[model samples]
Target: MTNHQETIKQLIEQIGILSRKQEAFKYEIFELKNKLDQLQSSIDASDNVEKATLDQTDYVVKSEPIASGHREWIDSNVHDEATIKQPSFQHHKNQNSKVTHNTPQKSKKLSPFRKSNLEKFIGENLLNKMGILILVIGIGIGAKYSIENELISPLTRIVLGYLSAIGLLGFGIKLKKKYESYSAVLVSGAIVILYFITFFAYSFYELVPQTVAFAMMVLFTVFTIVASLNYNRQIIAHLGLVGAYAVPFLLSNDSGRVEVLFSYIAIINIGILIIAFKKYWKPLYYSAFGLTWLIYLSWFVMDYSNDSHFMLALSFLLLFYLTFYLTFLAYKLVKKEGFAATDIVMLLMNSFIFYGLGYAILNDNAIGEDYLGLFTLGNAVIHFIVAAIIYKKQLSDKKLFYLATALVLAFISIAIPVQLDGNWVTLLWTAQAALLFWLGTSKKISIYEKLSYPLIALAFISLIHDWSYNYDSYYHLEDNLITPLLNTSFLTSILFTTAIGFIVFLQRKGDFISSLKEGSTWLKIVSYAVPILFVFSLYYSFRLEIEAYWNQLFSLSELENKSISDYVVTVNDYSLRDFKIVWVINYTLLFLGVIGYLNYKKIKNIVLENSILVLTIISVVVFLTQGLYALSELRDAYIEPSIYYNRGSFYLIIRYISFAFLGFSILSLYRYIKKDDIHKGFKIAYDIILHITIVWVVSSELIHWLDLAGARDSYKLGLSILWGCLFFPFNRFRYFKE
Candidate 1:
């Protein structure tokens, strides 16, 4: 009974182990089926050109149970990710075995690795291009040889060319499916040959009517385009376009029929535009754009006339511009693709080229130049509409959207200068610049902020032009009749100043600035150079205004009909010069005083602090050199005022006031330099400079006054008295004691 029980227990244990083996085998079968399914999918994608088969009779699966200890080793190896060999399956193939395996071998031509890159290039691209080129050259040589030998009539020659082209086309179409790339080369050659045949038939042989020849060539162009579309080849379309664009020039009779030429080019471009919308062939689109404009520009430069071709040229220019504009945006608006860098460049070129050509056309005509600004504004409106449409549609092409928005603003900014004259351009440009900056900061758009820079620069350029125009002695005497501060030029300068300063102010918000690297050149410009420009513009404008007022005052006094002010008096020209200089000096003092106040207020701007120190140094130098001389001249003139024009106390009071303001400006600088945060070394140097500058200015003023009162010969005595008076103040200071 015990022996029988042991036998039954061993049988049960064996059964349990066999059951686990069965589960493991089932899992292996599941994995094998999944791999087969994936292989089938790959074959389907390749059009089943390579077949794979798994025959039951060829592959034999065999399994054997392992001892428990060996199974334990296998399990441990699997956990350690070790490679363990399992039972093998035998695959066999024989005539009587009823099993066959098939995996189609890849052809050498189909496998790219079979050939080196040089061999492939020599076999594929170079050979095709060179062979076609050689064939075309051969045809030309043969035709020329035959013509020279009189072996064929012109009609026969033309007929032979057409037949050759037809034969090539037939061969290309036949071989297209099997040899698509070669077919493309053949088709391109055939199209070129057809174009030559058509041109010779019409222009050289006169064997065909012009209309018929044109229609035939157009048909040929259409066929080439269709073939390329079907074959998905851009090279064919490129060759076809080249042939199409060549037709007009090839058929040229020198009749100068630009209208017909432009019309034909327009038709060609329209087809290209259609292709752009249909396909993402950027090269084709750009070629069409470039070729169409090139043809138009060439004709305009070589043969265009204003009176004869003005309206016709205008129509065609607008048509071509609109076509390219639409085509450039087609991929974005229709296909919803983002703008590549080249796309943005082409778009910009299209716009500006059109504007420039249009401007030339308008400027050449009588009434058009007057409305050139309007034309520019019209362009701005068109782009604005485009931007609006893009925004409304909410297209995801952010680059294109930003570009469109920038274009609208750019056009508007440009139109100001193109349409308006003089200071009006500057004024409007500044306004636009401010608007762009505000939009940039508020909308968090960096492009707008960058664009604002150029507009502001343009405004500044325009402002300078106005200044030159207004202050030009020759021009001012004739054209400048407006008031000083209230004129358009001054207004333009103020607007420009405000706009740029506001841009600087907005930059302080750090919204637009953080996008820049901390120590970039542009950051330095905005931080340092921009503030200096502001101060310079302010100071220069005020100086010009003061000079302009005196100029207007004198010029109007000379005019009997013009009364600029109630106190217009005739004075010595020398006195007038001195008065102008004195007024400017006082204004400078006031300007410097205001700047010092800004520094004293602790604006915490490095540029401001440096500007004040630099300006103080400059002022000290000028006071010692030019300023003292000018002051003495004024005082001399004041002592000897013209009896006819006693422009009395204003001049004297201004001189004294200038001295007072100068002292105050220096004191402000001294206080700013003495601040605890300032470097002790900088403070010491600045204190010495300011003390010497103030003492020299005060003693000079007193000595000059005493000299004017007939103490000129006692100049040494005056110096001694002045030093004695200043010595008491210096002795009280701790630096003097040290």
Candidate 2:
């Protein structure tokens, strides 16, 4: 029993030791479980923190777990009333990390104003619309107050105006920062107000010294341009331009301070030009163009007595026009849009303005009219140089190049007429037509071709003018035909005729008629009339030559005393025996007929052939009858008295030879027409003309034979009887048979 008891004691000891060891292991397991729970809670809180950052809302810091003993300490120390306000160590550490991550985000959210959609809408859309209206109203109110009140001192008004402008400017700056859309209007309004204030201060009230006023005006202009560039606004530029131009007019007490006004304009335009280089504000440029020109025109029309106004006007005109030109150029460059029709039109307008202003300035300055040509020439040279520059730059725009060329040509055209008088002008015009024709046809340049027509017309008109009215200086009654033929007027006529003929030839060669095939009938008629005009000019030139020769040969001094009309009428003689003019006309008709027939054969033109045939027949009959009358006159002058005395053998020989030649010509023409395939109407007309010529030749020969046989009295009676008998047979057999 004692042994069993001792063993029991050992077992009890062993049980106590095992129980203690189990208790220690249980505490460790409990601690590990607590650690696992704390780790899981931290992971969940981390997920929540990530979700909170994404949502941009609440964040929580998870507390760490502690042992039971430490828990009691923490609960007592951290959760006590006084210590609860203070963060626990772990809580403080987590809170600092959370703040470090979120501080930047919070600051970013608060940096800008959180404007509502409605506020944004009003700021962007409504401000500019209302701003312009308010600006106009403000200007009207200011102007009305200044004009009507007279109560406020000028200095007070000036100060008030400046303050108002400054206020607007500051307001614009504030709006620019907060609401960008309203800034442009506010700033532009300020500029306009400032300009008007400066004008009133300087001109109307003398509130500021002249120098100070000028400086203020310049400052305002600069500010305006700056605002225009910044806001890309044209309204500011327009307002500033108007103020600049109107200042002079508004302040004009009739004491034309012309230089001062122009100086102000020049300075303002310089600012505008600087702005234009950066922005393409068309309204600004257009306003400047109109206002500047209008002011200058007003000054010109009023005839300001100040001699200095002329130079100032000229300088300002150039400045205003060039500034606008540069503005257009800038627009083209910035937009990358190619040259447009409007650009060409603007160029042309600038040219015209330059011309008008130049003329006015030169005329006002008492520059001689002769110098006007020099001015025009200089203008042309400037255009040529510009064209050269454009070409050298290789712009590669055909229309622009053509426009520049056209301008150069136009200026040249004007300059020529201005520089030259009389035939020199006509010669130059004719040459211009030739050059245009060549360019149009050979170069295939349609513009030049169209230009040729007008130039040709001008040349013809000038030629006619020279023929009719420009003869007095170059012509004298005592001058021979050679002198008149060699005169400038005559030479110009010849040149014009030759140039027209060549142009027509080129037109035919180039098939230009196909383009006109669909033209109106009047156009076709005009085409036919061109050849007729050529013929008429030749006829007139020949007639003048013949008349001059006749006056010289006949020693008809009285012919010099007669007017051109009376002389031409009285000198109309178709007598082959009296002068060579009738023979010359016959030869000319033959030459034209041959040419027309050849052309018809080559080109198959029926109108040409028919016209030539008709003209040839008519000319033969008219001249033949006139020759008969001329023979009668010669018989009376040198044959009739001699015949009475029985010495008219010379007249007999001459008359027979003329009749024989007429018979031969009639026979030849009849044979040619009958064989050739001509128009039916022309054929009938030619047959009749040939029969009449036959009868006239035969009857005249019969009468001459009767007169030579000493039956002179019977000659007249026999001639009439014979003509009566032959006319019936000739017409019945030749014309009626056909």
Candidate 3:
């Protein structure tokens, strides 16, 4: 029995060991299978390409594989197109509800946090604390010094403040190197502040201050010199330095050899050279050169006070050199930086200077006799050289070589003696008109760029022509008066103005408002004032034009005779202020202003937008009521008590207002009737236009009946367009939105 039990135990032990080994083998096999499955999944995931459609703000992904080997077509939009072949038996076996879990793909766009950092760099602009601090201290300290010193007046201090503001000017220089930016700003700021405070604060029991002030001026001058040497802050440094230069020049007035002036020039020249050595230094060099030349010219004139002829010669040479050197620099800059605004400004200023010099040579016997044809001919050569250089570089910049060429031509057209009928200036004027028209319509240039120039030129021509005609006619006082285009006489100039005012009303577009906004506040006021003034000036002239002694009357303006400008007093027959004519002009202006109202309305088809239409209607009513009163006064002045119409064409202001008012009334009436507002009799919109017309008609009749006021020797105090809130003399504050 014992032997049988021992055999069973041995067999049991062996069987138990075998069973444990088999179970361990099964566990290892299961782990290996899991590892294989995981490896396969990872490879598939790595190989898969996520694809998407680009929306404006988001991506729409299509879970697809990027096609391999067709590399040219792949983008973020590629689709996953890989196919896998499984054995039929294995597929059938593994087809028991196969599960899928999605794996999210990494996106191409960065997270919000990363994007925020990127935006901070680009959007905030020069996140420079040091630069800003320097600017503030410079401006603040300069102001403090000026106020305390009273060395200068308020206007001058403000002007210098603008020029000396060198603090934030690092950006202007574009000093891109990191360490350079820091070192330059810090060192320069420290040196400048110390120099100014030490000098400006100079006083010794206030006794030695005169000497100290003189000494400080020298040291400050030196600092300005060194400041100009600074790569990024030349302009500001120049501003501070110029004040010192100006004080002595003003006191001396070219009488003595101002030694201080020569020192100033030397310092400025050094600054110019320093800036010139930079990788790109056109703007700085040009500015520096310009300042230096101006100073030199001023000194030359002063030193050669006896040698007016030599001074003129030297000035011509200096100016010529200035043109040549700047042109060289301009050509170089265009090559490096391509077409830029700097190129345009440099071109414009230099061209104008050259032309002005040419104009002097052409028109004035003084410069003409000295320079002969050199400024004109030499200017052309310089222009050609610039053109060749620009063309040779083959630059593809949009500013192109054409602007330089056009500017040169434009300048030449005016400055070159148009000896075509030997009536050199008349031909020049004709060419001016032609060129002005061309530039105004040219697609390449902007309206703001050259549009005003032509109009201004036209104004100058008219003024000159009228003044000359007046002199010639008044010398004869009757016979030499011949009406040219719209008759640009003292009387016809006003009427011509009214005609042009009508043109402006018609051409008025939506862009005008934007232009008004973008333009200088003063320019905006003037642009509107042109049309209004034309109307007023015409009415005044027209009423007086019909009066008896008017033909015998003469108003000799301070025309070409500039020496008479200061001595110009209000002489009886020749008062330039001539306010006695303002009232009838005001009345005629009111009578005719409806033209502007209509055209302004028509041009702004979207006048209703932002209630400009309502504003327009209100303005029209206000002015029209004023106009009625004006028309009555005009009749009293121009017409006989017994008869009706006067001699001569109806003043443009009157014609313009009548036609314009009728046009607007018809249009508004049509719109109102269509809206059924008029048929139902005067809603808010209908009544606005109706009231406007009523005011005009009633005022016109009443003025004819009552004759409220004539020639306003003391300005007529009334609801005249000149004084009203709507239209009179233009609202100087129109540029402000409020």
Candidate 4:
């Protein structure tokens, strides 16, 4: 047996060795086949290329005139393909030969104008320009320190600054010719250093006469602007603007020289505006805007206490406005990029600054704060007029129109609250909302349509603010009461919310159906919100009236001291009043649900239809539950009279109302579930709930009547059995049918 096993093992080992050799042969054969296929494909591709080249040669010769150079180019490509050994290299060589031979004449013509290696070498090297920038700023700071410390004569520092600037300018011009790319940085650095030096020379050290210093500054600005235009680079413009704005801060010595500082800013901005007309540099414009406004705001905040600065503020405001307007013209009219987000932001920023400065001027008693509204209104009017002009000229972009409308509405929103007291503000906002809605829906003016949503939202927010005035009064017991709903404020709030809802509903009619069908999210939101907001307004008005009545009925002297839980304990005492309020709310909800259903029928929106149905069902359920609870309370009150005097009448009313609600809920559930296409499971759930409700209502009434007659326990048991048998079969039948 052992020998036989050894023979078998030997045989197995031999078989394994033979299997390994077989696999090795298979892989080698696969690789060889792949190599053979690649070689075949290469040969085929080469043949196709040659054939294509010959066909092209024939076509070119027959179809059009062929230059000798072009004919030679085709011949050279074919020769390269035949001569090259490696397939890849030969293909690339053929392509290059074809291109070179074809464009030979054009290349010869353009070679002279192409950049040389030396020029590229210099242009790529910016270390020298960066070093010069650092060095110039460092030297300026050092020179300023020397002058302040009296280490060197101011006149000597001034001369050194001039010489350095001149040397740098010359170096820049040389670079401009040699490299061109790095020239802007060098030139800008020189201009900044020179401007700083000139500013200190006149405004700080008094080393030069004011006239001479101003002339030198103007000359530097003119040179900078010219260089910036010549180079067509924004970096030069940016540096020049930064240096110009910085001069005021560097020279500021608590002399309260507001006029001179702003005058300097105004001149610098004017130069920037001119540069803007030539080149559209967003960074340059933004930097000038931010720095100028920041400096002006800083100066106003720090020095506006001095009455002499009023005129300075006025002049600077006008200058800033002009500068912004000019930039606007540059973008809208010159560059014709149309109005963009940046333009809108700049306009808003300008408006804010103008308002801030105007407020400051008024706060200083330079003008009456009451008349501040006049200024705001005037600004709004101007913006509206400008918008009208833009619209008339057909230069209005959506963003531009939106910004313009927003500014006007914002000013109006602010001015109304400030100028008018009491409920007038609310009325104004209501009118504004209506106007915006009208404009948004108008076919004549398309631009305002884009702004309609946001503008209406703003008006709504303003109306909210207007409604807050009556909040304290509506809730207050006595001493805190100020403005009640009987007053104009609350009345206006109600009227305004209702009118807005009406207008929104009217405006949406044209497109609401299409919008709904297209699944427009915003339109759906507005559609739902309008009715809900109107309902909320009515609810709030009712609440105010209820609170007022409650205050008159009870002494709320201890109201403030009680926690919410403590107040809830007393809630049952006013159950009757709450019942009345809830009854009104229930009917209101039902009415709104009906309206929603009608809208859904017209629009054929599933979401709207389902939402209204669900809301109505939930409301009915709640009303039924509350009615039961209220009846229970009334029954208890009749048994133990505290606030009521008619026990018999209270009990009768409770029973009648409870029966009425139970019947109404049952009918509503039946109608809701009877609708076709409802899911079987949901219908079954509704049937089960209705059956349970009917049983409870019947049991409760039986129990109440039985107690009144002093019935025995057997009667209750019999009634229970009867209800179970009837309801169980009915529910089972309903479920199976569903």
Tell me, by TM-score, which candidate is best: 1
Stretches off by above 4 angstroms in model 1 are: 1-129, 471-486, 510-515, 552-573, 647-655, 694-698, 721-737
**Candidate 2 on 654-700: residue-level lDDT in tens?**
56556555554454455447755755676667666766676776776
TM-score for candidate 4, residues paired by index? 0.66
Write one digit per residue (lDDT tens) for candidate 3, span 336-363. 3345676567666655554554444344
Give one clash count per candidate, in the order shown: 1, 0, 11, 0
Candidate closer to the true structure by TM-score (higher is better), 2 or 4:
2
List clashing residue pairs in candidate 4: none
Q: Write the per-residue lDDT of candidate 1 for residues 316-369, one digit (tens) a residue.
A: 999999998887776666554545677778888899989999999999999998
Measured on C-alpha atoms, candidate 1 has an lDDT of 0.73
**What does the lDDT come to for candidate 4?**
0.62
Candidate 3: misplaced stretches above 4 Å?
A: 1-295, 305-334, 339-396, 400-406, 409-442, 447-476, 481-738
Per-residue CA lDDT of candidate 4, range 136-204, in tens?
Answer: 868878886986698978788888888888788888889885456676677777787788778868777
Local distance difference test, each candidate = 0.73, 0.62, 0.45, 0.62
Best by lDDT: 1
